[model samples]
Target: GDDDHEGEFGASSGGAFHEGEVAFDEVAQEADDDRDTISLVVVGHVDAGKSTLNGHLLYALGYVDQKVMHRNERDSKVMGKASFAFAWLMDGNSDERERGVTIDVGVNTFATEHRRIQLLDAPGHKDFVPNMISGAAQADAAVLVIDGSTGEFESGFHAGGQTIEHTVLVRSLGVQQLIVAVNKMDNVGYSQERFDEIKKEVGAFVKRAGYRAEDVSFVPVSGFKGENLLERKEEALNKWYCGPTLVELIDRLHPPVRAVDQSMRMVVGDVFKTQGLGLCVAGKLDAGAVRVGDSLVCRPGDVEAVVRSVDKHGKRRRHARAGDSVTLALNGDREELDNVRVGNVLCCPRNPIPMVCSFLAQILTFDIAVPLTIGFQGVMYWQSVNEPVVLNRLLCLVDKQSGEISRKRPRAIGSSSTAIVQVTCQRAVCLERFADYKQLGRFTLREGGSSVAA
Candidate 1:
């Protein structure tokens, strides 16, 4: 049985086919299109008001009109969920509305004074963590929502909390900038003591999770009452907390440098048929640029397709560059369209991505209950792709400080250890070396439904 599963996804030893350069066409520049864009994902435990906070932010920014809010108020009240009125603005699905829990990634776009923000509202429930991973994979930064009510913060921040898991997940996926929004301060009567307690504890954990003190920021706000979001309207909050509002902090986030020189690559998040567009695939461009009439290919199948049009946040554009969440109108027949699935990578046809079944990875183990050993099976999540994988070999443990081999042929790796190990996937999937591509190479490993390593 062990032999049957070895190299199920890719070869035991191999490298990507070629390191060829792709010819990219110059994109037509649009006038005054200089505003930077940032993809932000809101994450935390269930009922932490992630959706409510973001939903109200959109409304306060005038993205949602009064008529819509009034209707949502009436409808949510009828369903005995008046508190979910703001959340309904983000949670569009009927099931999510009725259940009062976000099940899928709710995406919406808004702009600050200096930035165009594509907000991704991630599900907080543990069952939906995989979905959250999908959202975090696309995000350049994260907004970790924390409940400030008594006992709530402890529950979400302690061992086995989604807060801890989310922090690690986002950081492992290459999200550098973090904004910890201490939501529901109204419950604590806007107490400075409570806010400081949360800040101190969360701040320490964030550092341990690989975030610098400078990159991590904290803000106190009431998601339900809508205070300290756009402005610190509450007199109580102003006495002790004289800091930037949530919107202000968001506007201050640094945009990541785009990889315009690399070949075009985008991982498909969603695929659907449109009336006029024929077929469309939505994703954040990971590298290079794409324009109308550009030829592309989807990996694992190597199916060729053409870009019919490019659109960002529903606005038609002639081209889109790296770090943009865009929908590409693709031209293809029925058979070709059927082959394009989520987790499939789209790149320039001249240089298609490689499919790998096995590769060596440098992973950092968390507080896993069981030690990682040879033949250990777990799910590997890379970008939008999740595959069954086996730890085919134990290479060696490396010292974090010295950058030297700690041990050769380590039989087992425990918690908080760094090791280079060979992993085999159940099937071939497209991935690049982390040294070559930071975003494309990083991944998380989950075992027995818990995130064990990254």
Candidate 2:
């Protein structure tokens, strides 16, 4: 009778389970089957209300409780007025709270009408630019927040001109869909003129960063007052606007699609071992697929191993697909697992290549004071790896809009200059061409102790 019932409706009734259990299992299975999880990172200049926007989105989705909000509001008194309730969600450390800024990346999740979103809130301060780079590297889309009232669209000389620099860096890191949130609208009376000015300046910067105008969305909102974030409010205050709310805009973003037929390549993020699971490597699958019985090689020494088991989000599965965070158990000694650190690529043994040494890279310089020349050392950030490398030669610096060399062997590249350079690393590494694999192609050059561009 159980087999007959299951066959009729495609529902499996595990033996010894009650009717209620069967129904619950069926509903849970359906929810798990939905493949619409999207990853987005919120980034902008410091004090741009990035964390506040994230808090509002979570509250609207019913994920953050009223008690937490109350506690945050009370804690705001101890902190500055600018940080109010936002500090709790973004300030994870005591120093960050005291400084009244976000220093590291904070990850939170919320459910929406069409899909589930994993929001990575990155730091906006200039000193914490490295953290922003790391968070942006893992994001599929990005939301750039700007302060409307402060009118701080461009960075001053003292701030290292970080506004345009950060924009260029985020775009080069492969964030396609960008949503520019002109925050603090309440401070400006939600004026249409102010919004337009910000929109125009940001639009110009986005174009200079090599992104099309159509791919960018501009919205006016106050993260502190929770305006234009989740729900619609019919008030004369913002009568001039009739666009989708921020949450709705986020819901409409399609996840970055990866080519399924590409060669098997997955960047290693972490290596862990469970009491019963032996050795496991955890990271998001960038392209292709991996099965339990598939054999792969970890570079730098040509270590080979066979996949003993695969687990995705705590469920044992036969295989894992692209964009899935998976952990693979191996059939070899766990000691060798340390070699597979973050930034290392896992590929087929027959197609093994050196994971280190020098390579030609197309670069963009965000610093004007420093000259990009031969024998100049700068920090290189690609994928999950960040290391110091030397600029071997100034190959050719070309302007993307005109496709011409602005300078040949130019000694210095001002802010927002694109170039193709030859860099030699102290160690071996792996990188994919920008046209082939955008994820591994671009890199950020940090000189003068700051991130220039990617």
Give lDDT per model, in order.
0.86, 0.71
Error of 2 at 315 (Å): 5.5
lDDT digits (tens) for residues 98-152 of candidate 2: 7778887787767677866768888888888888887788777889888887545
Residue 362, model 2, lDDT:
71
Per TM-score, the best of the predicted structures is: 1
The numbered model that scores best in lDDT is 1
| TM-score for candidate 2, residues paired by index | 0.82
Could you list the CA RMSD of all candidates, in the order they appear? 7.1, 8.8
List candidate 1 stretches off by more than 4 Å: 1-32
Q: Write the per-residue lDDT of candidate 1 for residues 19-84, one digit (tens) a residue.
A: 121112234535535779899999998889999999999999999989999999999999999999
TM-score of each: 0.92, 0.82
Give model 1's TM-score versus the native structure.
0.92
